[model samples]
Target: MTVTEVLRRFNRTYTQRIGVLEESFLGTGRPLAVSRLLFEIGSAGAVGVRELRELLDLDSGHLSRMLRRLEDDGLVATTVDGADRRRRLVSLTTAGQQAYDDLERRSDERASSLMAPLTPRQQERLADALATADLLVRAATVRLRQVGDDDPVAREATRRYVAELDDRFPAGFDPGPLAPEPDATWVVATSDGRPVAHGGLRPVPGRDDTAEIKRMWVDAGWRGAGLGTRMLRHLESLAREQGYRRVVLDTNGTLTGAIEMYERAGYARIDRYNDNPYAEAFFEKELSSAS
Candidate 1:
């Protein structure tokens, strides 16, 4: 079979094998969707309703109906968040906790039964394959989009990036804002409506032909998924689209991984172009139509 066909076949097999098509999942008289929602809420203790919608990629109306059903069944409760009165939080009730425990037990038993027929070596191979598949699927599904500098998600990503810098640098870093550049283009990489990475291209002070890349950061958890390269390439593409002929970026000496990534991406070391005290190395790449 072709790769796509093989993937489809595996998806169909797995969904059927897991009883996903059944009206009652795990014999609990609830659909797979409701059961999964309960598991998520139970695992998190308490989570914002908006967060649940983002996590599950569910519409607000659908989630509201599900929450109402769960409330009617005495399995879940929603309350206004103390810190954010305008937002609602969802949590499991006592009966909901019991149901979650039952679901967990059933899931464990089902997994064990599925593994029973496999030899030890076969099981190891299956696990390795699943891990690889999971990584590839997540990497493939990550989405990149351009947003305004002040967009809430973009601002949150910048905050996280600076927080990491402060933690990693010998001297703690300041969370100062990037220089305001009206021409700057900010891009945020998201997966499941959550920002995983961010970067941007902005004008070089006196050089209209050069676009300086700034605020490049990737979440630690997503680093190895080739997301960093994707973000870099996306910024480069943006620079090209904006009619820039060259791009420049800088990094701290302590950021050896980032330095290496830049080198691999065809960026060459350059003299200090800016007086940013924290920057220990600078790199630049000339862009062409073929780039």
Candidate 2:
């Protein structure tokens, strides 16, 4: 079978085995969605309604209906903030906390049952594979888009990137605000509307056919998920689209992970081409038209 077919088959079996199709989940007498929402609120103590909606990627209308149902059942309560009446906060009631505890216990029981038949080694393997799969799926869901350098999200990403560099490099790094220039492009990778990775390309000084990759960074929480490599490839594609034949980047030697990723992505070590004080290693790659 094709890879897509195999993935779809696994997904179907996994969902069914996990009782995701059940009308009630974990025997909580509520649908999976409601149970999941309750779990989030219980874990967080209290959460803003808008934040919950964003976290769950639920439509406002759907979320409101769910909250109303929970409120009617005396499982949840909502209140408006005195400082901001428009902002609604949600919290689980005492009964809701009990229900959440029950759901957690039942969920643990279900997971234990699933693993009971497996040997210890097999269980370890399954856990490792699941972790890898989860990270890969989360990375795949990140959306990359080109944005103006001055865009708030893009600016925020660059600021974080610089801050991280300052912390990591022996000599602190500080960069000026990104200025608009021809053939320059900045891209941000966002997960759930929050910037998680960013990179940019700009024309190389005195070289019309070359671009320099700058400010490539992934959030610390997201670093090991292959997001940096993905962002690098995206920057290369953007450079190609802008008619550049080559791309170069410089990095501090302390960033071994980034250097390794660049090497793996076909970037070759090169002599320093720029006078940036923070750069200790330089690399370059020839871009293909197909990108």
Candidate 3:
């Protein structure tokens, strides 16, 4: 099957698994929204209303109403932010703390009940699949933003990427941003509003519309979650969006997974594009004008 077909098949199984845990866990009369709020607030002990809203992506009025209802039910209380009075912070009341524990206990019981029918081996397999699904889906949820490479998240991603390369390249690697060109777009991927991966595509200094992808990186936990491929696709799409017809990149021989990804993603072998002390393999992909 094609790459798209494989991804689609996994995604369907993915959403079904998420529905089972995140949606089915809420007992009758409780929607996922309220339960999620309670879980977050419960975990934090106390959280700023604004922070919750931002984290949950809930609108102002809606978040306020949820906190108000939690308050009415004696589950939570809100106070002005210590440093910023205008900001309202929400915390569980003593009663709410007890209730939160109950919620957790019941949720655990339900999970256990669901797993009871399976044999020990089946249960183990299920657990592993669930863990893999969580990581894959969580990774797909990260958004890529176009920004400057020196930006904090971007820099962190670059640093991590170079560190990984340094480990692979016996001769060491260049830690600088894409050799600095006027035409480059830096894209960083973030989960929970924190950077976890990044890459860049900059026009080859003297070439017309030909650019190179660089500074690719993904966090340790997210390494095998298909993020590197996604980041590569994201950079290719970005290059195409900027009217380029092709994207080029170079890599050291030691990073096998990255090499495989580029090969599988349709990047054809090319000769050395730069003598950046660490490069061992070079590849490029042509884009259709319609892209």
Clashes of each: 0, 0, 0
Clashing pairs in 1: none
lDDT preference between candidates 1 and 2, better one: 1
The lDDT per prediction is 0.90, 0.87, 0.79
**lDDT, residue 25, model 3:** 44
Candidate 3 residue lDDT tens string, 197-245: 8888888877777878987777878888888888888888888888788
Per-model TM-score, in order, reads 0.88, 0.79, 0.71
Q: In angstroms, how far off is 162's CA in candidate 2?
A: 4.6
RMSD of 1: 2.5
Report the C-alpha lDDT of model 1 over 1-291, residue by residue, as the tens digit. Answer: 998999999999999988899999978889999999999999999999988897888999999998898999999999999998999999999999999999999888888888889999999999989988886787788888889988878989998999999999999899576765678899998776688999988999899899999989999878777889999998999899889999999999999999989999999999999999899999999998787
Query: How would you order the candidates by TM-score, starting with the best?
Result: 1, 2, 3
Error of 2 at 201 (Å): 3.2
Candidate achieving the largest lDDT: 1
What local lDDT does model 2 show for residue 98?
A: 90
Q: Give the per-residue lDDT digits (tens) of candidate 2, residues 1-291.
A: 997897799899998988899998766789998988898889889888987886788899999999998999999999997788998889999999998889899999999999999999999999999887777787988889999888878888988988998898887877775567656788899876578999888988799999999888899888788899889988888788778899999999999999999999999999989898888999999998765
Q: What's every prediction's RMSD, in angstroms?
A: 2.5, 3.6, 5.3
